[model samples]
Target: MKTFLFRSIIGIFFGAFLAVLFTNAIVIFEGRETLDGALFIKNSIGSILCGWFSAVSPLYFEIPSLKLSQQTALHFVTLFILYFLLAFGIGWIPFTWNSFFITVLIFIVFYLIIWTCFYLYFRQQAKKLNAELTNLQR
Candidate 1:
């Protein structure tokens, strides 16, 4: 419970930071001076929720009965839905089929990149641990 709360708080802050950075970039690119207060608040909340879920979703993997693939699928779908809704709601993407397709493609690419990185890292760690165990058994 403590760890969960800690991660949630971390996620909230991360979300807020990303929201600010994203908003700034968009403003600069569009030559905007400022954003509407209500819009800013809405975006901030959305980002926070996304971040919170991103952090907490990994807990799904702790279920011993679930295969790795199942956990991964659930995590992917949950995040995708949350992000798609948020992006569409915030007008970051248009309500068109083409836009949705492109967004999904981009999301999948990024998700794969991240997932692969983590997989390789953990594989490496497992190898190191196995090597250590072999040495100890000698």
Candidate 2:
């Protein structure tokens, strides 16, 4: 558990650095004229990557489980909650949509995309790790 936690922390740190670097690059290349475009893209990507890391960390680095599916489900749930909270927090954009419905729709779509990617990636990793463990046991 300790080792997994350590490695997961390292992964999150690395992921965060990558997010910042990518966001900076976008701002430099895309010019400051389009604040909304740049900020939207940067925020979406950063949040997705953050969600992915948070979701996968438990499965890849932290917990050992008797059933791989169980672990994956737990991780997925955690990621979903984290992403929802993030999306909700940012849902009320300072000056965008006039109606709350449109705002929520946008937020939900963004959250779905990020969550889907996180789920797929976590599933792949869990499968690979479980296979490796099986081989080791054999």
Candidate 3:
């Protein structure tokens, strides 16, 4: 729990940085500007909280007795729900059907990228371990 809290706090800073960077980029490219410093501060705080929750929520998943595929699907479903609720709740995006679809799609892509990286890393580790075991047996 302590480590999780620390991770969440770190995620807050990361999320805030990404939020500011993207906001500035949008303003530059899209001509859509924030009205004031206060709005920007509010957005920063909202994004920070959203990041904190997103980073920490996965710790609570406890589905057992399922195959890895089933567990992974459930894990993604949980993430989609968490991202959707938190994003909509924070006013980070609008509440239209189009907005919902776009947000969900983005969330799914984010998770897929993360999972793929982890999968590749672990697969490499497993291959190394198997080769080591083969050498040991020989």
**Candidate closest to the true structure, highest lDDT:** 1
lDDT of 3: 0.76
Candidate lDDT (C-alpha), each:
0.90, 0.63, 0.76
Residue lDDT tens for model 2, 7-63:
566766766666667667877998755556765665755555564566355653345
TM-scores for every predicted model: 0.87, 0.45, 0.67
**Candidate 1: where are CA atoms >4 Å away?**
24-32
lDDT of 2 at 104: 61
Residue 105's lDDT in candidate 1: 95
Report how far off residue 98 is in candidate 3 (Å). 2.5
Candidate 1 scores a C-alpha RMSD against the true structure in Å of 2.0
Candidate 2 regions with alpha-carbon error over 4 angstroms = 33-56, 60-65, 91-138
| Candidate topping TM-score | 1
- Model 3 ranges with Cα > 4 A deviation: 23-35, 58-67, 136-138
lDDT of 2 at 35: 54
TM-score of 2: 0.45
